[model samples]
Target: MKPLDEQQAAARSWFESLRDRICAAFEGIEREAGSDAGFAYTPWDRVDPSGEPGGGGVRGVMKGKVFEKVGVNVSTVGGTFEGEFAKSIHGAGDDPRFFATGISLVAHMANPHVPAVHMNTRFLCTTKRWFGGGADLNPPIPYDTDTADFHVTMQAACDAHDPAHYPRFKQWADDYFYIPHRQVHRGVGGIFYDHLSDDWARDFAFTRDVGEAFLRIYPALVRRRMGQAFDDADRARQLEWRGRYAEFNLVYDRGTLFGLKTGGNIDAILMSLPPLATWS
Candidate 1:
């Protein structure tokens, strides 16, 4: 494997730091709930199609009283995009070589009222360099207050960077997260933006703000509803909703496809899956 450039090293460092903070926050929540659960971290390596070293990542997961299952992963990978896949990635058609570093997180709460959530932010470099990712809330039993808060926090993050960003990215998330066949959305929409290569410094700052916004808001939301009472019917509804989430990740998620195409670690790539889900 080649040594990381300055930008790549900085991004990888920030991502790993974010992962540590998030895991600590979650463990604190577990302690509050009278459970001592903590995240278990597993490091995995990747091998490119050429059988050369490709960078890898650590997968951190925890199952606890509040958070039924949650995975926080940080990876820094560099390799060539495989055949047809090269044509599909931005800026990679002509030069398939690429470098990517990012953090991805998904949490499915034990209590149905406590929403499940997904958040990811990444910096990728091919012929073009860009940053992309977003966060969304998924609840089987939706709440107006929770939805409003989540959107407002995300909007603030966007507004700090560019006033135009909130509306544009929010709609992008709405359109991107939809399950076309089911005619339903995976979750209440957040902001999703891609191919943001205009200015590297500005774009990277915005990406960092997105991560900070999620760190501030999501834990508060979790603590708010984690103690709420839920019944079997509620659990059933959560499971059914998770089925739709699964479908979208398996079929429509670009991140999933990128991981597979890049020869990323299978278990780390799939850490987004809920610990348990039901189709019906």
Candidate 2:
């Protein structure tokens, strides 16, 4: 693989910086809860048959008094897409070469009232380049205020770029996150956008704003409800909800499929799964 160009390097750097900020905020939450816990980062590399250097990522996770389990990962990788998958990627029709950088996060709170959430933002290039990612809330016990706050933040981010972006992506999230087999939506919707085209500079700006929106809004919600009391019934609900989350991620999520297809580290790819989940 060739060296990363300026755009790709910048995207990767920003993602790493975002990961650091998010981990710091979550650790601060743990500190407020009087837990000594903080994130532990493990680095991993990708395998490419051509002996090309396919860049790697760091998997950062924290288990603490407030956050039950959270994984925040950032990676920048360059390589060729394999066989059938090549046809499906944007610019890989003839040339399967690709470069991608992004951050992905999934958080499951210790308290059921404190919602679980997922956020990811990525920049990918093949023959063409574009940005993609969004965040969503998954509360076993929903709060109207929390849902509204989440959407409000995301909407503001989108509207700043294109007025149509918020409604369009919010609906995209509503559609994309659905579990058709289970006949249910994943959670209270946030926003999901992919292939945000036009130009790299503008698309990157919007992507940064989306990350900022999540970084600002989600920790606030977590702090608000992390101390709430819950009983066994609530615990049971959270577990059952985790079951749904696990199902969607393993079966329907595009990111999960992408990671697996690209020979990503198995443990980091599977880190989105809840620490504990129950079905039926």
By lDDT, the best candidate is 2
Model 1 ranges with Cα > 4 A deviation: none
Q: 1-280 in candidate 1: lDDT tens per residue?
A: 5799898898888889989999999999999999999999999998977788998999899999999999999999888888888999999999999999999999998999998999999999999899999998888889999999999999999999899999999999999999999999999988999999889889989999999999999999999998888899999999989999999999999999899889887887888888889986
**lDDT tens readout by residue for model 2, 113-198:** 99999999999999999999999999999999999999999999999999999989999999999999999998998999888879
Error of 1 at 17 (Å): 0.8
lDDT of 2 at 262: 86
Q: Lowest lDDT 10-mer window, candidate 1?
A: 263-272
Q: Candidate 1: which pairs clash?
A: none
- Candidates' lDDT values, in order? 0.92, 0.93
Q: By how many angstroms RMSD does model 1 differ from the true structure? A: 0.8
